[model samples]
Target: MTTLNALHQLDLDHHIHPFTNLAGHQSRGPLLIDHGDGPFVVDAQDNRYFECVSGLWSAGLGFSEHRLADVAYAQMKRLPYYHSFTHKAHSPGIELAAKLVELTPETLNHVFYTNSGSEAVDTAVKMVWYVNNALGRRGKKTFLARRLGYHGSTVASGSLTGLARVHDDFDLPAIPVRHLTTPNYGKEARPNETEVEFTTRLGQEMQELISHEGAGTIAAFIGEPVMGAGGVLPPPVGYWTMVQRICKEHDILLVLDEVITGFGRMGRMFGLEYYGITPDILVLSKQLTSSYQSLGAVIVSDELHDVLVRQSAQHGSFGHGFTNTGHPVATAVALETLRIIETEDLVANAEARGAQLRAGLTLLEDHAAVLSSRGAGFLGAVELVPDGPAGAAGLKAFEIAHKHGLILRAVGDALVFCPPLISSEAQIDQMLAALRLVLDDCA
Candidate 1:
């Protein structure tokens, strides 16, 4: 076995991690994760810690699920490689597509495959534009997104993403998109604004933006059901209702980027279902295969799919997709992943465990370091009363959390948590206890 020192040196010499500060990593080195056991990840030194963010908000079944591995092994042996391009097709891809359409709303009856959530978002953008062009609405190319809503890191998708970190030096939003205010009551609400009033104002802002941008020029409005990367901000009351009404009122396509909230993260199969609103396009990834394989799907309404059909007929093929658009093994794993989610009823587990988590975070609100707590289902966040700068307290708590045997993601002063759907009540208690100790140290 390679020594930890040797491994660390090799990683430092070669690896370029995403969404990490390269300069800091060079000085601090990597926390080499050797393996995963249930909801816990084991470091190279055999130290175990709860992966609270579920490996970037994926990993619905946690790590080390042998069933997924077994399915992958079997699928590899049967048909390790195949692509869904041209006129050729494979059973796994076809079956998975069928399953997705079945799971989605009746209006969204078609599925397009991609390799990642970013790619799925990009695909959705292209599909929406293609549909508009087919319908001869060439001017409808602008997209409306939220300031903090996270879409993906690809060109078009990253443009949909509203984070400065994701945009800095990246020269993104390569597509024409408008960003609105984040629907965060904690951070954006007025001094004396009530929740209902905040929601009303936000809804009005969307309507006003549509009018200002000219509804005929807007292609779609995309957002996360619960803004995950943007500090786990759930929409204010009546926000989705208003967004849906405006989209329908102006014939703008509604796109829900459910990559983080899909497949039981929000205690439902999809975030749209959790929020009780329908979208013309639903983007999915991350938990699609429990992150065992890289795969994503863009499910579009039947109306849009018909436009795609007509456009493709004129354009010769859709003129979109990846080399591994519908890789056989990835699709096979997704099918098995969905089966496990249903068989184990992990959605219900998320709801029950989420209740416990929310209650625990609510208790933490009394802590001197904590200003407030909020979340939905298994997604939660606790904003700290930072003693120093804007993000100092949150960063300190994240570092201290490691010592307490926990891993949490920080978006500024907000420490967000997303434990695996399979995490137990005991594990949840352990996580909360570790968090309490970490908070005490931060305080």
Candidate 2:
């Protein structure tokens, strides 16, 4: 056997892949990746596949950017690791923090580093409790998240996540986190309800929850600006505006989880910008380093930062930080990534290409198997209904597309596509062609 085959066999025997069926994977073996070039990743057998999901919706700059590699090399030569605890810091971390404050929503000014989105979300949850403790509101501890919202996979963050599979067999949701309705028009909207009325009803349901739970006892309301892992569902018109107003009126902290929607994924630098809402605390990851490295950030508003500072001074140090927090290599890579996004105008590109993607995917809506197509910028999903004995056609479409040199993801019965921001119009067309073939094959 070749080295690649040997490696795959070893991996199948030794590794436990995340979110995968272990026994099935053992039978099939892993798709051992050897290299990548410009939106395409090659397996050990030299078979190339278009990475439609952006390698878990994180590789916004694509896979073969030498600039990112150079940044990592330079940072590793200088300082590879560092902790951001007890006022200790490094140059790359400090500079990246400054850039984040400048680039994020104006209300957000403080940046807390974490190793991943899960850690960032867990940190946000702790901060909510800490802030309430500082303010002497001991009763404010419960958190409210939307039913389809995906925050992270850590204990607290996973509890905040509303996906059922993430909770099954994990004994998760260890904390008191309430889940509300997801605003998926196809799945949840009533026959007579307009999008506007649906949004209003959801907002009212939130208001009712606040009243029932006692506003004094609720700490924060966490949600993605556009539900990504829940199947890339964007909010209805005026949905976030109403949600923000309700949160403010109830004095509940609004925590926007932008792990998947941040860094130009939603045609803007942040989903909050797309939705026109100013959150008090924001969770960011994924596209921050563009999967070049593992890094996450919890951005706090000036108000929350002030409160945290005061509380820390009174009690002691903040007393929370990860060992790899503000890792120099990751920070340097992220800094260069952001610079590339700005210099290359990738955000604008995502907006333009996103329109083309949406337009192309919209054509699929006429297909008998397709139920709906929803997207914002490059992130999108096509919901499929059961056609014949295949059950969920979208899932079969995903597998078919994968075999046809395209890697797509299926969330429930929906096929999700989140291509890189650097993707060209031709690449978008190629993706659509592959998708069309898959859909036709499925039919």
* Candidates' C-alpha lDDT: 0.91, 0.89
Model 1 vs truth, CA RMSD: 1.0
The segments of candidate 2 whose C-alpha lies over 4 angstroms from its true place after superposition are: 388-391
Best-matching candidate per lDDT? 1
Give the lDDT of residue 400 in candidate 1.
88
lDDT of 2 by residue, 114-157 (tens): 98999999999999999999999999999999888899888999
Residue 367: error of model 1 in Å? 1.0
The positional error of residue 419 in candidate 2, measured at the CA in angstroms, is 0.2
Q: What digit string (tens of lDDT, one per residue) describes model 1 on residues 138-164?
A: 999999999988998988999999988
Candidate 1, after superposition: displacement of residue 387 in Å? 2.4
**For model 2, which pairs clash?**
none
